[model samples]
Target: MPSEQPDGRGVPSPSQVDVVVGGIKGMLLDGTLGPGQRLPVEADLARALGVSRGPLREGVRALSHLGVLETRQGAGTYVTALDPALLLAPVSFLAELQQPASPALHEVRRLLETEAAALAARHAGPQALAAVQEALDAVAGPGAVDPQVFVEADVRFHRALAQASGNPVLAALVQAFAGPAVRARSRAAVGDEGALARTVQEHRAVLEAVRAGDPDRARRRMGAHLPAVEDPLAGAGEDPDAGPS
Candidate 1:
């Protein structure tokens, strides 16, 4: 049975998990809980939130999985560093499961990647640019013909580009879409002799624009590149037996 307070209110009750979760979230939003700060002792926190220990622990576990909290052995739980990439890990998994890519997801990727390319051009330093170039070169190397190797390199190139944008959130967003994007490209590349070559060329063009520090050119190149990769899957979501246009 739930515990009751004197005022006819339920103490440590009424959706205990939600109450606990909301209490923690409220604390976070109000600056009471900052990144890397250790949470109050469990018993103390539970009492403060008017929830039982079970629900409080469960809520904490949930937040930990979401990358909003971190638990250390014998050190107690603390807020995570709040890195965008860490926070978006679950989002990446969800994006990957939306097989073949949906129009909305593609649109999101296009917008984010286009901006990332421009930012990369303007802000990417020598080291970051070199990483992008390395990924690009890997795609055009001897093993480029291998589908797995080619796709891996392709994903890496985009990832590097996103990182070079100097926005961790943007980079994480790009990575979230990468899995489905790779699958779409991989499906299109199968038995298509020109597909791999075209992809390498397109990536080269984008890289060249970024290397030249031309933001407009980089954005345009990326805008053009995504469609080329996605076009082959145009009707992928339509009737399975429908004839190709």
Candidate 2:
């Protein structure tokens, strides 16, 4: 094992990790490293960064958590593809930690999804539209009679809508919001007053608008569908997560 410097004794400090992090980030900025590039071995990287192995590992772990890097068993660490959805995926954790944030999450989701629906109406091709319709049918079909099945189907519908929007960043943002939406839907109390039926109808309304190529109506319908989710989440205010499916 390599020995730490005199000042680098005991547990590693933020400064030590910062050295490693800053070094790698500088390399990335300068194009010395890039998406899908493999990192050098630990000893060499530590030597290059002028940091101890402990801090280098911590820095790498931190970057991995942020989806900036990935470590494969025996294959070593490499930069991720840096896709928008992969980077934004960690936002899902926010709802789990602070339950009160669920409404805010839904609001952000609503804004993104409404615009996405409008864009989808404008840009969706036959295949994209078909994909969305298939997702919608899954939500309204037999298996969705089960609550958990309904939640999964509902998420797929939203994901398909986002994909049809032709905006990758917007789609990624919408995908990240799925965590809160699923958490809220699973905990919701559905009724014979037609909660599930109402949801399916709302989805149909959005689909109708999209099929008609009416951007404004698609936006309006999506806007309407999403607010229903917000109220239930607000009412549950900081309730325990039934656990994100």
Candidate 3:
């Protein structure tokens, strides 16, 4: 494996193996590494990242766990299908890390979800519309202030709406970002006051625009709804305590 120690020249550490792996992972996340594209030969990658073959292999294995790449006999490694569900496996792993600090996943989630919400408004079908209404009803009906139940409904609501966008990959991305604490913190931030009430209204706006088949309106409405959730994260510097729950 590549040494984790820094080189005498004070180069960016001798952890070239991790560097290679992280480089490849970053490429995948940024869409530079697409599914079905073969990776360069081990020697080539090693030279590029200034690492040896041993650490390179370890890096590949780590990304494989995230479903980001695959190796074939004699054919070498290739990027896996750029499916959202596949991409999200690492999210469960990341979730464990969140309990220790404020989760940064919400930022990623907000990006995907806001996009999904906009798309759902444009592409929603009768069934999709029904799902949105059901979720909204769950929030509005009696005994709605229960945070846990409301949180569950909220997840279902956003997820269902994302799926309605007719994009499975996008839906998966949304789910990965929408971690439990992020949801809970959002609820807590808004509390049982007008914030919750505003959420219902925003969701309704998204649904109504979708029902009307107005993609632009849907997108705008969805975009409008995100500020309230995002504001706190902006002030909190990404890991600020969600405060007790």
Identify the candidate with maximal lDDT. 1
Give the 10-residue window scoring lowest on summed lDDT in candidate 3: 236-245
- Give the worst 10-residue stretch by lDDT in candidate 2: 236-245
TM-score quality measure for candidate 1: 0.85
| Predicted candidate 1 versus true structure: per-residue lDDT over 40-134, tens digit per residue | 99999999999889989888988888899999999999999999999999878878877767777888988999999999999999999999999
Of 2 and 3, which scores higher on TM-score? 2
Q: Which stretches of candidate 3 lie over 4 Å from their true place?
A: 1-64, 68-83, 91-110, 180-184, 189-191, 231-245
Per-residue alpha-carbon lDDT of candidate 2 for residues 1-45, written as tens digits (9 for 90 to 100): 123434446664457787877788898899999999999999999
Q: Give lDDT tens digits, candidate 3, residues 1-245.
A: 55677578867564766787778877767877778999888898788777778878888887887787889999999998867788776775676467532436555665677678668766778888898789878887654477766677777778788889899988876666665544754566554355566667667777877788776666666656655554433222221122311
lDDT of each: 0.83, 0.78, 0.70
lDDT score of model 2? Answer: 0.78
Best by TM-score: 1
CA-only RMSD, every prediction? 6.4, 7.5, 8.5
